[model samples]
Target: MILAEELTKILSSDQVTQNLTILQQHSQDESFHEPHLPDVVVFPKSSNDVSRILSFANEHRIPVVPFGAGSGLEGHAIPVQGGITLDFALMNRILEIYPSDFCVKVQPGVTRLQLNKELKKYGLFFSVDPGADATLGGMAATNASGTTAVRYGIMRDQVRDLEVVLADGRTIHTGGQAVKSSSGYHLNGLFTGSEGTLGVFTELTLKVYGIPECVMAARAAFPTVKQALNTATSILTAGIPIAKMELVDSRSILQMNRFQETDYPVMPTLFLEFHGNDNGLEQETAFTRLIAEEQACVDFIYESDSKERKKLWKARHHLSYAFRHGSPGKHIEGTDVCVPLSCLADSIEHARKKMEEADIDGAVIGHIGDGNYHTLLVIDPDDPNDRKKAHEINKAIVEFALQHGGTCTGEHGVGLGKIRYQRTEHGNALDVMMDLKRLLDPNHILNPGKLFPMSSPSTLNIN
Candidate 1:
């Protein structure tokens, strides 16, 4: 009852639960990783509560894992060590909004959709969306990026500062309100994607944007993936300043039709969007249509009405779910590799070819405007061979991407899934990362089995 006694003192009995139901809820994220239930789960209502809990946990050398909405595809939110899972649900609040400064200071549990809904009155919105309605703190933790990343950038770009509760229970603020700063140690960069290993986020000061004056969504179909990827390449080279560009292969298109129950063209397609002032909107649309036609477009469909535009993107956001709906009882292995924009086409082609040769049942969809694509491998999770084949394909895809100056994961942070690739991806630089993790979390009490492997901290090699 020592664990119960301490946590109950910091938070009420209701705030700290040893109930199996709540522990089960915090056991896993939306990943294929093995789940481990924490000994106790604590819901902190404010920064001071979080500070006290972390301080106590640190003193006892107990593992502490911070959990948000549990929407992460990797196992970033899982409490593998099963010590104390700190849930920030009670901290969900939009503390302040500054329209003139174009930013907002918020509690960690605020979500992207919730934030944008409030920002609508002031014509402001948060840009980064990692598909799920993930909490802002979780988004920042993963450096999550989504459809608008090509234009507005990722989670790292959205942050102006963060109120962090370190492993030792000390409170510190990273960065500042300024849009840009050459401050000490670049704590923003250090902790933004640290995945809660260095410190737990208590408050986040994030950048937001004024809503575009006009937005036009279009669906352009091509007879083949090559043609579709080529069109994306041309669009990038053309420098058209479009807002969002996504590529969905025919395989994914078939599933999208099944999932959305819409008979969109059963061909590879690009979901494109353009935003600008009212003056040249039509001209921009016409210009984009012309560019697609030049790249062997089968047909191009446009959505100008705000409601229809939202519907179109909403369907796009649920592509992975669509694929899952079509294939029952199959787990998804996302081959997330991002290369240089110039090499994106090559990278995708390589992935497609590899999947074909392996006869893996999968579909391809991507935020291609920024050179990141995921080959969704939906397979029977119970089959060892299927799992092995999927990993082989993913490893090959990551190797190809790394060779082409790409990363193993673009938007999804490296949790337990991609931990093996760190040595290969970061080279000797990973050593410094391990050193930093050890330095900040001397007891290794923070999210223990993520980012870097704990099996051999000194030896980078892993079997």
Candidate 2:
């Protein structure tokens, strides 16, 4: 019997599949990276199922790639070796809720929107929103952060514990129910962003937050990118405690206007939010308005009503799709680089100039509050020149980020796309990382050809 038949012996027949359509769906993520099909797909209903699947694959030397919602932007979900793809859809369940402790335990497949909808009853919500309704498991894998990261922190901060199934099928819990610990190893931090190369996360205990008593959203348009950046930095310098600070350039605003059918000013803009009690928010917005005005803010619009506030954020979240709608017959090559606040303006300006020099149609958008930004480049996949220009621009941006004290990838994990820069970004630490990977997965049956670039197509030799 083949791998699918063997897996059926371990799992229910309905849980094991080699269907062409399912394989095609599991082949890639939401990225421009080339797709490759998995040989078989298996859905695990419990930790025991995951353990059995890993034990079998490890012994037989078959590659196993853990897959969640496949919403990743960096090709992290592709099963390059064509072995088994472990789909977590069947394992999605919010196992526990401790409202007083501000923690929730969940299976790996639960999506952000699904969890938030359920959390609404207790006036609690998970804060690490990566815009997409991405599975919490996938977000944990990528260490995802979004607009609210400046206030609530990244997925790494939200994780309290992880129940991981090792390559040899040994089950381990990286952490526990306690809020803080001076424990050994800090395994939770290590495994949270391992990108499936270390082990498979079967269960996650994440930190949640109570809904803020008062919230407000504002939009400030600036005459130039520098002015907008200056205003944002000023707010942070002054310690205004803003919940979310997002930057959208003129080109992005134009696209958002056309796609969302809203009349936002066609200029560089900052989407700002404040979360606190009414008295505190009143003071914060007042001080923030003062800073924006001093920096030559062209227009400042406030949305106090909850409905209008939600609508404002909705437009910002759908920006990637808006770019797609604005540019047909083209794919978006999103560049993720983050720099220190002091260098953010220069980095962004450099990215914009590179795009202009290449004559590429794209937009600059980001979570400016925390200095993570994206240069969305629209390129015709069929045109070699377009692809080359996009790659060159991305390289320039990454080089600039690395030259400064910034990361090649801020929120997006180093999958197939960012592996080339791993050496430059992490240096000797990359060697240490590879050593750990080999130590945990001696046979390299975990996700291969990712995070660490392959020396050859058929082997996992990193040196």
Candidate 3:
């Protein structure tokens, strides 16, 4: 098409394409949201390439969506307006490594596994693992957190700086290498989870951690969800430095057993981990065990062997896919909500009741240590009734979270999936956010049809 030809002139013929296969690939992500094809896809290898492309698209009023690994469950990378899709696949490069400062600089296309693999040689690691081997750019855009977040923190906390190309094609850096500064607005936090609506990330400077001296993984099963959640809260309340704490309901465990071929008991389970020196870990584990026993935990299995620990976490990481695998022809619509710790059990119980009332099929799994949980709703994609019921359950759960000082999404950013909750969750603050969007992207060319407009935008105003 004409757009591809023009972008080719700006970059190279090889970097720009209207190939039907490539367009189809960029149309959707792992989300249940319907996909839309972009008019063209452009591959950029450097910040200058991204800057020039943004400039050309901005002048002509074109929607530009940044594409990453396409692993997002919220359609964060889908190019709904069909303009120019910026694929950063060629920009995968680890630019610098400062082991002394426990930091690393990397291109947007670099995956979490890729960075962690390299950091292994230096005895350091990047912690914000959202599973799925997702690109670091996508993780930052979503502000992803995973099992380890209870200890190390989320993606926003780890990002030291970001090099961004704005809507007008101007290049700017959000922050520097300094550990802390009071110099300016905290732009680093602003852009990190902007969901590609504000700008495109070209490079990221992130903090890393030294691998723990002693690491252990354990599984504790409880008779009920409440007991498991109570055990997790108790461990946290007692000041145990648990590295990773996850909740997998009995139904989810059934799916995990079928998928991973394990003989774990079908019960509400808390997958736990501890990090510290040998002596400290021993004392912490003992205390945690005592707390679990008090909560009537039926089984407490611990492992220090590296391979066994990997297998344990592997099952947790792939639990979502397991749900999909178990259901023959159903699509999974995962709901993410984070309530206050005091309200987590109540929120989850509410979700369970709503799903029962709607007669929907799904399982509950989450990073319960931080009061975040997800209900994986399975529905027949071809059945409108089924889809409606699943969404209804989702709405009830999100409303419960919002009513109790919680967010609609804890890790997944406001993509097309969570736009309806923006007004209620942010109140008047959402208007200020929209003003910022207008100020930064006056033409609305940067990722239009996302994080605004309550519903999908049929026609975006480019004037």
Candidate 4:
């Protein structure tokens, strides 16, 4: 057990919360998993403080779970082993804005929406947007990507640099302000999605993009998911540079309509966004319509007005909540899978059939342009049978994706949910990962019991 005197010496009594209720709140994230409360919750206000706390924890061989806002779908921020919960909420601040370089430096606790709001003053915005108002640090740690990832790319792509605190109180800058680099080791890439198992990120320097001159958003409907997916593929094959293309099935549409109090056709639909000047937008829309027609699309409607487009996308953004709203008292379990573009349609169809065979009710949604999709499974948390069926469905979906040359997860990093498939998916690569984990975190004090299963007692030699 960690000594209270040592902790108090590191951080103020006010900064360290010993309350069981507060610790419980910090234990679990938005995942459906049971909570494991940390022994103590430490709110560090600076990089040095974080480093010192980690140094002490490393010396004591105590698990240190770096936490952001705890909005992750996966159990990324949960303190599974129940040690110290390092909350970055107090460190929230925008450190700097390099408008000319198109990058911003910020603390880990700053949310994406908060960063974007500040960036709007300079006509710049960070593009990697997961649906939830997730912290930028949490987003980077998870390597999160959402609808815009089809065009702008993931959090790893947007990150320019990271100020990471290693296990032994060492601070290192992984990347830099330069737009491109052929530097040594590519440590930035290694830590971006490390999910706090490697180190705690104190500050992040992220790449930002200039706001588009003109934007056009559209919704295209089809009688079936096959047609909607096919339309998306056709549009991509036709060389339309769509900024964002998302697939929403009929079930999800009904949920959206009920939750948002707005009516959309209860059919498989594709939400699209085009970013360019007026003429380019017009051409893209025309080309999109032409390609979608080949896939038997029922209708293709475009919204050019900014207000109306925001309203439309807002509804799309609330899809997960809509699923939860539609099924009261049920928890939402979303499966994220990415298949090769050639096999995306088949994969979706296979998953849909499996859900039907199991008599499970869920909705299929996708960042179709990238061949990545999610099936939101709403299940009664109180029912063990329901939970078992959801797991089976998840397993089937993951297996289907792997069979199709796809990853177990698209954007949501391998937290507790996908750990079982690491060996199956990566094969020999898993051995290399184990080596890497040992080399960096020999003590295994950082977010223990996550990302990888516990190593055999004989294999661990922490000294």
lDDT of 2 by residue, 1-463 (tens): 3778788899999998888999999999988889999888999999999999999888787888999999899999999888889999998999999999999999999999999999989999999888788899989999999889988999999999999999999999999889999979899999998899889999999999999999999999999988999999899899887889999999899999999999999999999999889988888898999999999998998877899999998888888789888888889888699999888888988999999999998988879988899988999999999999999999999999999999998999898889999999999999999899889988888898899964312332111
lDDT per prediction? 0.86, 0.90, 0.89, 0.87
lDDT of 3 by residue, 1-463 (tens): 3777678788988998888999999999988999999988899989999999999888788889999999998888888878889999999999999999999999999999999999999999999878679999989998999888999999999999999999998989999888888988999999988999889999999999999999999999999889999999889889899999999888888889999999899999999999998999988998899999999998998888999999998888888788888888888888798989999888888888898899887888889989989999889999999988988898889999999999999987779999999999999999999999888888888888888872222333321
Q: List the residue pairs that clash in candidate 4.
A: none
Instruction: Provide TM-scores for the models.
Output: 0.95, 0.97, 0.97, 0.96
Model 2 clash pairs are none
lDDT: which candidate is best? Answer: 2
What tens-digit string does per-residue lDDT give for candidate 1 at 410-462?
Answer: 98889889998899999999999999988888878888899987641221111
What's the distance in Å from true for residue 309, model 2? Answer: 0.9
RMSD of 2: 2.5
Per-residue alpha-carbon lDDT of candidate 4 for residues 1-463, written as tens digits (9 for 90 to 100): 3354568898888888778789888978888877788778889999999999988888778788988889877798888877788999999999999999999999999999999999999999999988889999999999999989888998999988999999889999998999999979998899989888889999999999999999999998898887888788777777776889998888788889999998788888999999888998899898888888887788788999999999989878888888877788888878788999888878888878877887778888889898889988878888888899889988999998998799999998888889999998999998887788888788888888778885511211211
Q: In every candidate, how many clashes are there? A: 0, 0, 0, 0
In terms of lDDT, model 2 sits at 0.90
Between prediction 2 and prediction 3, the one with superior lDDT is: 2
User: Clash pairs of candidate 3?
Assistant: none
Query: What stretches of model 1 exceed 4 Å from their correct place?
Result: 455-463
Clash-forming residue pairs, model 1: none
